[model samples]
Target: MITAFLHGFLLALGLILPLGVQNVFIFNQGATQPRLIRAVPAVLTATLCDMLLILLAVLGVSLIVLQVVWLKTLLFGAGLVFLLYMGWSIWRSPAGVSQAERPEPFSPRKQIAFAASVSLLNPHAIMDTIGVIGTSSLQYDSPDKWVFTASCILVSFIWFVGLAVCGRLIGRFDGSGRWLLWINRLSAVIIWGVAAYMGWQLLASA
Candidate 1:
């Protein structure tokens, strides 16, 4: 159980350390929001989505889903399209929040929806959970498997909340629009970057 817990925690931490679209979005939101609490919805939503995926993967549902070639292909295509759209939207968002003309904070609904898209739609994230975490679980006994699953899920929450907290701290010095504007630009890049990678994989597999 100890070994399984350590393996799951370390592997999950590694897979999630990338500056991927989901992480970028969560960070940007935390930086942009007027209050730290405003960023909570996005953080929780993203964490929950990942938790669900990890759970499903550990339970072997991911393997079952992967058996459907056409369905997986269709999902990949849709995810790519969604990523493009999301990237464009972020790029077009207001550059900064000034006292005179503050940009509206993302509502709870919008935050959850976008977070879900970034978390659930990205083929890279899905595959990592399914491939790394799911495959690792196969080597564990029932007790160790549960411990591994719990530890992996725990890491997701820790990482997401930590990111939001870091962003909140950065927001203090970046009161100007410049920092946030650049963040949006970078966030857009991250989103499109993942989209491009997935697109290439799909093409290569074709």
Candidate 2:
């Protein structure tokens, strides 16, 4: 049990450590929002989404869903398009116009929806939770499997919350417009990079 739990934690941390689309958006929200509290909606939405996916994966649902070639292709295409759009938006956003300074704040509803999209649309995330976490669980017995699943779920919550907190800390020192502009620029690149990679994989599979 202990071995399975530790393995789950270590594996999950490794998978999530990369600066992916979901992490970037969460971190951006934390840095751009008026206060750290304002980023909670996105954080919660993302955590919950991961939780759901992880649960389904552990129960062997992903093995069935992933068999549909059409569905997988459609999801990858949609995810690619959305990533491109989001990347462009981040790159082109006005200067010195974070949520704190802008007259129009990003509503919680929109944030939650986008957070879900970011979590669900990305095939990479699904594969990690399902492909990696789910497959990993098959090696364990019932008790160990549940312990492993719980450990993985716990890591997701901890990582998301800690990421947001780190963003908030960075925001404190980056009062100048230069810092945010560069961050946005880098974020745009990372997002676009993911989109391109996903697109390539889709085409290759086709």
Q: Best lDDT goes to which candidate? A: 1
| Model 2 misplacement above 4 A | 97-105
Taking the tens digit of each residue's C-alpha lDDT, what string does model 1 give over 1-206?
88988998998999999889899989888877889999999999999999999999999997799779987888789889999998898888776467544344678888998999989888778888898999989998889999999999999999999998887787758766677778778889988988999899889877
lDDT of 2 by residue, 103-196 (tens): 2224799779778988999999998888889998989998999999999989989999998898778766776655666777787899999999
TM-score list, all predictions: 0.94, 0.92
Q: Once superposed on the true structure, which residue ranges of model 1 sit more than 4 Å away at CA?
A: 101-103
Per-candidate clash tally:
0, 0
